[model samples]
Target: MVPTLNAIRHSRRHLARWMRPQRRPVAWTFRPARAWIRYQPLGCIGIIAPWNYPLYLALAPLVDALAAGNRALIKPSEYTPRLAELLARVIGRAFAAEEVAVVTGGPDVAAAFASLPFDHLLFTGSTAIGRRVMAAAAANLTPVTLELGGKSPVIVGPDYGVRSAARSIAFGKFFNAGQTCVAPDYVLAPTHMVRPLAVALLREAQRAYPTVADNPDYTAMITERHHARLVAAIEAARAAGAEVLAHEDAGAAGLRKIGPTIVLAPPAGSLLMQEEIFGPVLPILPYDTIEAAIATVNAGDRPLALYCLTHDAALREAVLARTLSGGVTLNGTLLHVTQDGLPFGGVGPSGIGAYHGRAGFERFSHARGIFQPGRFNGLELVRPPYGFVARRIARLLIGR
Candidate 1:
């Protein structure tokens, strides 16, 4: 946590240096024949952060808000109070109370926070909760930026190395114990390759986290409710005829240990296929063609992220051209969010706004247009009623 906070502090200074001199673009040049206008500053902003990656998420928007010269109010997730208080202290050290304030509490607090007439609000969380936040913001007609998560998918092509592909995919799906919104919910591999890929994935999972029964690096589900939900989700998939291909009877007691399992051949309408399985339980489905995989995804909400493992450039290009996801990763997963210079949000049910790089700046800013009138006297034709001269001037000026 300390290390993460230190990184945030470093980034804040770096961004401040870059943004300090950018009040308006220096490229604006006055023409002798144009109209004049000026840019304006937005007042203040509000941000609601999620429990996962609390410090980083909170500080990310704070960095943009301060750099954009707008005061901000932050409502950190009540689920993690310690981190929220820690943020308040750190930010207080760096800014005035009013410049960045921290508010705490339950859904009611969140509602009140969202109802305030903020110039802009940025929220990060589940899509269901995001809808409520959006509805609250609508009360004030406040502009909002939502970073919601959905069922991200992975496609494993036969052309790639199965072992290597499975290795990378395992790390991504189980990272943070699959709490990540962008984690691959299910896998679409070739029908003939499913068993081979599944075997390789289990092998890689063991390689990545040997002794998951006692590993400290593994993150527990945030709450008992989530843990039960994950368990129930897996059960529902199993009852519906999906074979639980891995982790049999390992996760019991309060250990909160779910050793990277996979469900095989789940029916098309099973819960495992319909929702984001944000756990270590990976589901593998067989696909005859990549086109069929694309069609399946296109039928649903635009995913937050889509991943594919293939060696052929043509196949990769074809898939990218035909499908829409918040982000696409070729032959890998979850690396796109690490690109600090790239935008990191989604589209459609996955999300609506983007932030990171230039998108972050634009999300917190309102770009006002400026036009300057020239000194040339080309418009003094007929300043009055209706005449032939006025009509001609109108035709030339208005292009009527």
Candidate 2:
């Protein structure tokens, strides 16, 4: 709700500023002719939102779409039907069909909704289903913006103390039990500091939630199946010579509530390292050099967000330059997306396109180019009838 409300207020405050036509510079040969980009809403938008942070994800985009003067049809995740129903009712009370509406359904209904010929479609979910949504939208040539999740990494710089970086990463990784899309998937630490970073991460988690068993402060995994999956992955990593660290368990059941833990140097091929944990488990990988750490991140698909915690400005700038991601949060985690000024989204396999602030307004809009002719405009000299003057002007315009 924090990000969502922030987006709403940001859009309301900035919509007019973004809507102002942008003047474009004209060529010397075309003097007196004016051109500007006029922002207009892309008639109807179809938004497919995900389960995690359901309210924020669905309405954040909706706010931008409406602020840009476009109506929207939102399809909330089936996993959160009750919340979806509440959203529909609340929004219905405020908006008419011509402005905004919600469509609640399961997978098939979502598929049908995605196939509709909306001017634009924005999807926020996992990478696997993101492909399917893009394919379905492709059938209608609907432009899409997908906010998919990837294995975002937190790098502990050689010059920085593990205590500070580990503290930030722990808060991010365990928030909502690591279900956040931009949560730190794993940590890349200096070889000598791997053990220290692990211990520091556990310390931070303990400080945050001392009683992990049924502690309301600790969020539960989405499902029993998800909990079981985390258990299996941890077991697999343990079997593959990875040390798993967890706090003293108030042992009743590991079903929905798994204690915060960290994995020390899980094998490169293990499930703990391969997939986005999206649970209360953090994995730390040690590297000998900065180049190797950057290489480790570049080896996989570009992540949605990269966390670099270092006091050295040169090292921070170098890391940002070498790596590609949807966004970056220096010396912190998950806070970048909350900033209304910066655009947010992923690159390559991480996701597609971006939105937020003016970016969001523009994403759901078409910047229609408007060209106005002046009384003395000389463009006619280079129009259809090609003569010596026309040919000469054309050549000049083409930089020949």
Candidate 3:
């Protein structure tokens, strides 16, 4: 934990090391039609980061706001106070008090903080909290970039590498106890491969982090309330006629260590399928055909990320065009966020805005157009004289 923590601290400071010498420091040009635009700065931005991935999520947006030359007031989630404090200290060391400030508090503090008329607000958390954040920001008519999470799905096609797919899915779904916003919420495996995928996931999870009981790699639920809620959700789904599949050598039942749980053939409205399961539970739904699985995801709100396992390029492109996820990965998971160039964000209910790479810097700053007009030009056609001859030329220019 100490070594990992130290490395995270090191990485946060070095995140912008490669960004200094770029040809365009604050802007990116993908086409050649643009002239140099002045670097516009933004005012203070308020960032509300979530408990999961507190360090990365908080620092990513903070770095973006700073890169755009904006001051920031970050409110780290109260659930992880120790981590929150550590980050606050690190940020203080890196920046001045006026440039960046970290505030740690509860719900009331969050409400008060959000009410400030910040230039913009960047929030990463649950959909329920996102609504309140949006509403509070609306009080001042402030723009916001929300990074909310929903039930992101993973589809396993028959042509996929099942062993590799299982390993990736298991690491993502159960990593941080399945608390990731973009985690593979549930897997849609081919009907014939459903059982095999589940078996593979169980084996891979055990192999990746041996001894789920004493495994330091495994993350504990943030709070007792959250843990209880997860357990209740599992029980409710079980009572609703859902089949729960157990994994071996999981752990003793009393260690507050909920083992790797798999639910097979869960009803669409079942609690397990309805909401985001932020636990070590993986719901495996079987589909007879790949088309049926795609339809299932398309019917729901667009997810933060989608993981598809297939070897066919045509099929991959078809899925990419048909589905509206924020991001997609072919035969892999959680690697999209690692790409510094690709924009990171969500779509629709999953989220409203994206921020990463140049996108992140742009999100924090306003783009004001600067049109330097020539000394004497086409404007003479619309002079105050307003003669018929001049009117004819004005109409040509203005499309009157």
RMSD of 2: 1.7
Model 1 poorest 10 in a row by lDDT: 22-31
- Model 3 misplaced stretches (Cα beyond 4 Å): 1-36, 248-255, 398-400
Error of 3 at 214 (Å): 1.6
lDDT of 3 by residue, 1-400 (tens): 3323433444455545523432332222122223334546679999998998888788788767877778999999998899889988988998899989999999999999888999999999998899999999999999999999888899887888779888889878888878888889999988889888888888888787677677777776777777788788778778888877755344534456666778887788877788877788889999887688889989888999999888888778778888998888778888787665677888988898888757777788777654433454455546777898787876765668
> What is the C-alpha lDDT profile of model 1 across 101-200, one tens digit per residue?
8888888898899889999889999899899989988988888888888888898877988888898899899888888878998888888988888888
Runs in model 2 deviating more than 4 A are: 251-255, 383-388, 391-400
What tens digits encode model 2's per-residue C-alpha lDDT throughout 1-400? 7778888888888777898999998877767889999999999999999998899899888888888889999999999999999999998999997789999999999999999999999999999999999999999999999999889998888988888887899889999989999999999998999998888889999899888776788887888888888889988889988999986566514647888879898889988878878888889998998899999999998999999989989889889999999999999999998888999899988899998888889999999998887889787877776789999888878889
Among all candidates shown, the one with the greatest lDDT? 2
Pick by lDDT: 2 or 3, better one: 2
Q: What is the total number of backbone clashes in candidate 3? A: 0
Give lDDT: candidate 3, residue 318.
74
RMSD of each: 3.4, 1.7, 4.8
lDDT of 2 at 30: 69
Residue-level lDDT for 249 in candidate 1: 33
TM-score of each: 0.89, 0.96, 0.89
